[model samples]
Target: MNFLVVIPARAASTRLPGKPLLDLGGLPMVVRTARQAARSQARRVLVATDDPTIQQTVQAHHIECMLTRPDHATGTDRLAEVTRRLRLPDGDIVVNVQGDEPLIEPTLIDAVAQLLARHTEAAMATCAAPIADAEALFNPNVVKVVCGAGARALYFSRAPIPWARDALADGRKCLASGLPAWHHIGLYAYRAGFLRQFPGLPAGQLEQFESLEQLRALEQGHTILVHTVKHPPTPGIDTAEDLERVRKILAQAVTAPPG
Candidate 1:
């Protein structure tokens, strides 16, 4: 299955300006993300950004980069422009890897891609992991995904779903139940044709309420296959604190060296 990994990057991050260009150890954050994407089973990897600095940084690393409109409301919209400009085939798989996740697992990328390939009926595919922390489960910033039988996403939301009514009566019981609470992973694989048509679809009410683009796809009746990843989802750099966390992770990874 042919796949293209597109990383959407923007310079005007409200929490951290020029975030895509921020240094991650010795390399630019976007370049580090592209490097991880390169490890995936993708046929090609491209960084889509509206900032010239990001484009230059990616090109300096000899990675493919596309200049897109800065006003894109969502990463999917930026990816649409990339697919259009690249003229990818309708059946080709395009994975949207967030640029801020410098530590994104390549195996998860391969898994999502393969899931999309196997489930041709699904217009898109994504990943999720079990949320072990009760706080994270309830935090609106941590999106949750409920999957139906056969791993199809039933819904995506910022609120805790499948709320265990009785468990909430005792906080300790909720954590001890061992019931899996899935946390949404930002990675996504989409058919090139569907990606091209994404921006034209009317934004769904649920999507607006949750502020999750994936919800829009669900509301439009598009099937999204969800692949479960065993590892914890990589922390995406959303602010200075997140950047520091990623730096520590990378530092440990470097010092620990594979056994």
Candidate 2:
């Protein structure tokens, strides 16, 4: 399945300003993310940005970049504009890879795209991994997903879902038997047609409350296929601390001896 990986990079980050231009190892963070996506099976990789500086930086690396309007409310909105500007075919697959995820796994990208291709009835696809600890299960920053039979996401929330009613009431820290908690990974695969239509969909109440754009699709009765990744996702840069952690991790990997 041929697909285009669009990395929506905005220069204005509330926590870390000029985040896309920040240095990651030797390359700019946005460039590093684009390079990582390039290793995927995507037919093309493009960075959609609203800042001239970001566009120039991406161009300096000889990577394709598109300048989009700065007013887009969300990354999905930015991607919709890209689909129109480039006039991608309706059936073409477009994967939304976050600009901050420089360590994103290429195979996971391929897997999500393939999952969408296999589920011809679904309009979008994403991935999730099993939550290993109680702390993450209760962490609001960690989005959790509840899936129905055949890997269809029933709901996504910041709260611990599929709540272990009896167990929790009993003051138990464990989850109910057979109910596995999974954390949602912020990656998505969409058909170009759905992506173009996304902006027009009414903002969903659930989406507004959860601050999750994907809920708009769910609220509109669209199906989202969820696939489980073989390996856990590497951390994405979100704050100054996250950036430093990833930098040290990457640096260590580079200096480590060949085993």
Using TM-score as the measure, which candidate wins?
A: 2
Across residues 1-259, which tens digit of lDDT does each residue of candidate 1 receive? Answer: 5788999998887899889989888999999999988998888999999988889889999999989998898889999998898898889999999999888888899999999999889999999988887888888998899989999999988978768877876554344366668998888999999999999999988888888888878889999999997767667899899999999888888899689
Q: lDDT of each prediction vs. the true structure?
A: 0.88, 0.93
- lDDT score, residue 253, model 1? 83
The residue ranges of model 2 lying beyond 4 angstroms of the native Cα positions read: 170-173, 176-178
Model 1 / residue 95 / CA error / Å: 0.4
Residue 15, candidate 2: Cα error in Å is 0.9
**Cα error, candidate 1, residue 193 (Å):** 0.7
For model 2, residues 115-148, the per-residue Cα lDDT tens digits are 9988778899999998877778878999999999
TM-score of each: 0.94, 0.97
What is the lDDT for 46 in model 2?
99
